[model samples]
Target: MNPQASAQRGSFRHRLVRKKRMANSNEHNAAGYLFIAPWLIGFFLLTLWPIVRSFYLSFTEYSLLEDPTWVGLGNYSEILFKDELFRTSLGVTFTFVVFSVPVKLFCSLMVAMALNKSIRGINFYRTAIYFPSLIGGSIAVSVLWRNMFDLNGYINHVLGWFHIKGVGWLTNPDTSLGTLVLLNAWQFGSTMVIFLAGLKQIPQDLYESAAVDGAGKVRRFFNITLPMLSPVMFFNLVLGVIGSFQMFTSAFVITNGGPVNSTYMYALFLFEKAFKNYQMGYASALAWILLVIIAALTAINFLMSKYWVFYESEGGRAK
Candidate 1:
């Protein structure tokens, strides 16, 4: 063949291959979209759309029964400046977060340490410990908790067996919040599992070396185990804070914001504003305010994590 004809033939073959490649890419893209279509549909319809609509509605006064009336900053102004219940609920939520997160984390960590041991019947023990987390937030547990804290419930009944008078745990303002905190603490099963996993990842050689250096259990935990587990602890701390802040079911079912509003969580307050009083706009505003609070706290955790959270991959130096 002539030289020009040879070059032309080569160019034609290149274009043919490019077209075939493009066709395969298109097929793959179509298949991927097909596979993900359900998730995409649910995300937009169930999650994203509702989020955007609620944000828009936050500035409007709407009863679900009527067209939304735009109110600009009126709802926010009222929540921040005029609403006494908002402040009370926020205080209660803050108190819960402060108490519940630490207690839950402590219980989780201690239980995790216990479960990390190579003991007989360990699997059964894990299942038993973790079972409560599966139904910890359910209405059933909340109702049971309500009865258990009632003046004549199982807890008081048991106390009576000891010849001790059981005060009204859920009815007294001083003790109502404590019951909720204890309930929250009881749900440490999930956190404990995560902590157990983290514990398994820690190198036993480190503990052995610490023991060689005359470090007791307490010192080894503080210097070696704690430093090694700091990243996991940071993760658990952030999650605990967020979850405690949003606790609703227990307070709603057990206390109903009673006992002088001692257990009035922010979520319960939002629920009443939206469902009970039909203040949809107010509730939306409250939701966004909650988002901002959670975001700010999460940001703070991330910022402070640099000081404490240790990673082994930071070039042999603490990160």
Candidate 2:
């Protein structure tokens, strides 16, 4: 073949290859967008729109049936001063978050660590540990929790064997919040699974190297495991705090936020305002306030994490 003709043929083949690669890239991009479109639309319609409307409604007195009356900061003022129950609810919610988040995160991390072993029947163990989270917050589970904490319940039944006197786990105001905190702590399976996945991602060579350096298990965990797992820990911590702050279903079902309103969480307060008292606008304001508080707390956590949360690539350097 002539040299010029051969060169022209090669150029044509290269152009065709480039065109095919471009077409394949466009196809992948289209598919990626298509896969995410449903979630995007759902977020805009159900989440984004409601959030925007709620913020507006926070400044208005809007019964569902009637037009919203502009109330400016009246709702905020009432909540801040006039409403004693609101203050109590805030205190209860804060207490719940303060106690539950750390306990739940710790429990989750421990369980995850236990599960991150080369044991036989690992899947079975995982399933058993995770089963509680699956049925958690259900009406049946709440009923069981109520019974388990009741006077002369299974807990008391077991305590009798040990000759320990039964304390009111759910009935007494002093004990009710603690019972709810325990319940919250028990459902750490989802966080545990997340942690386990994070643990699995850590290279085994690091642990081996640490062992070679004569670091004990505790030292390795503190120096290597915790640092490598910090991102997941941070995620679980933030989520646990948010979930604890919004705790309502268990309190509603088990105690009805009763025993002197000891278990009255913020979401329960909002529910009572919106549905029981027909104060949708006030409830919306509370919801927005809760959102602001959560956002602030999460932001603080993220900022503080820079000091302690070790990344894998951080080379064991303390911030």
Candidate 3:
């Protein structure tokens, strides 16, 4: 056989093998897309379309009963300039975030540290503590919380033992917001779980070394645990801030944003505009404003995180 012919035959076979592999790769890709088609369709139809539609609706005058008329920035202008309720709601939301996020994070970290210890039935204790998170956001729980804080309710009954008379927690203007903040703290179970997971990742040797260096518990926690936990704390802080800004269920069901609108949260305001007044356009604008506020805060958090979020792998603050 000619050497040239042999080379030509080998080249042809190589091309054929390459073509076969390419065909198989294409088939695999097609099958993968087919498997994810449902998710893609659901995302577009249920999630993305609504988001786009709402953004479009935000620039119009929509009352749900009438066809939406294009108003450009009219809705946003009105909400920003003419809406007193919007300002009140925004102020209330800011206050809620300021009070709730720190309290929730502190409670979560404290509870997580306590539960991180090894003891008999520790698992049971963790489960019991975490169980509230499963049902914490439900309407039933909000109603129960309302009743518990009522003037003649469970909280007052409990306080009576100590001769401390309870005020109308959800009804008073001064205390209504505080009650909601307390409720937000009560839902710290999920945050505690995240903190606990982060705590577990920290090396035991670090604590032992600190102890050997004559560091007391307070000093050790501030110097060791906090730096190690800073990354987790940053994560929880961002989530807590976002969630607190959108807080609604308890405020709506418990206080109804009442007592001179003292607890008139942004979410409750958005809900009332969209549903009660059927002002979809105004509501959409409010929603976008809230989104921007959250985005701004999250961006600030990311920018500031480099100063505090110490990554163990990086051996210092995250770059």
State every prediction's TM-score relative to the real structure: 0.87, 0.87, 0.87
Candidate 2 has what TM-score? Answer: 0.87
Model 2 lDDT vs. the true structure? 0.89
The lDDT ranking, best first, is 1, 3, 2
C-alpha RMSD for every candidate: 9.6, 7.5, 9.4
Give the 10-residue window scoring lowest on summed lDDT in candidate 3.
17-26
Candidate 3 ranges with C-alpha deviation above 4 Å: 1-27, 316-319
User: Where in model 2 is the C-alpha error above 4 Å?
Assistant: 1-37, 313-319
Please tell me which predicted candidate would have the highest lDDT against the true structure: 1
Cα lDDT for residue 311, candidate 2: 71
**Tens-place lDDT digits, model 1, residues 92-123:** 99999999999989999999999999999999
List where candidate 1 sits over 4 angstroms from the true fold: 1-27, 160-164, 315-319
Q: Measured by C-alpha RMSD in angstroms, how accurate is candidate 2?
A: 7.5
- Candidate 3, residues 195-303: lDDT per residue as tens digits? 9999998889889998999999999899989999999999999999998998888888888899999999999999999999999988998999999999999999999
List of clashing residue pairs for candidate 2: none
Error of 1 at 200 (Å): 0.3
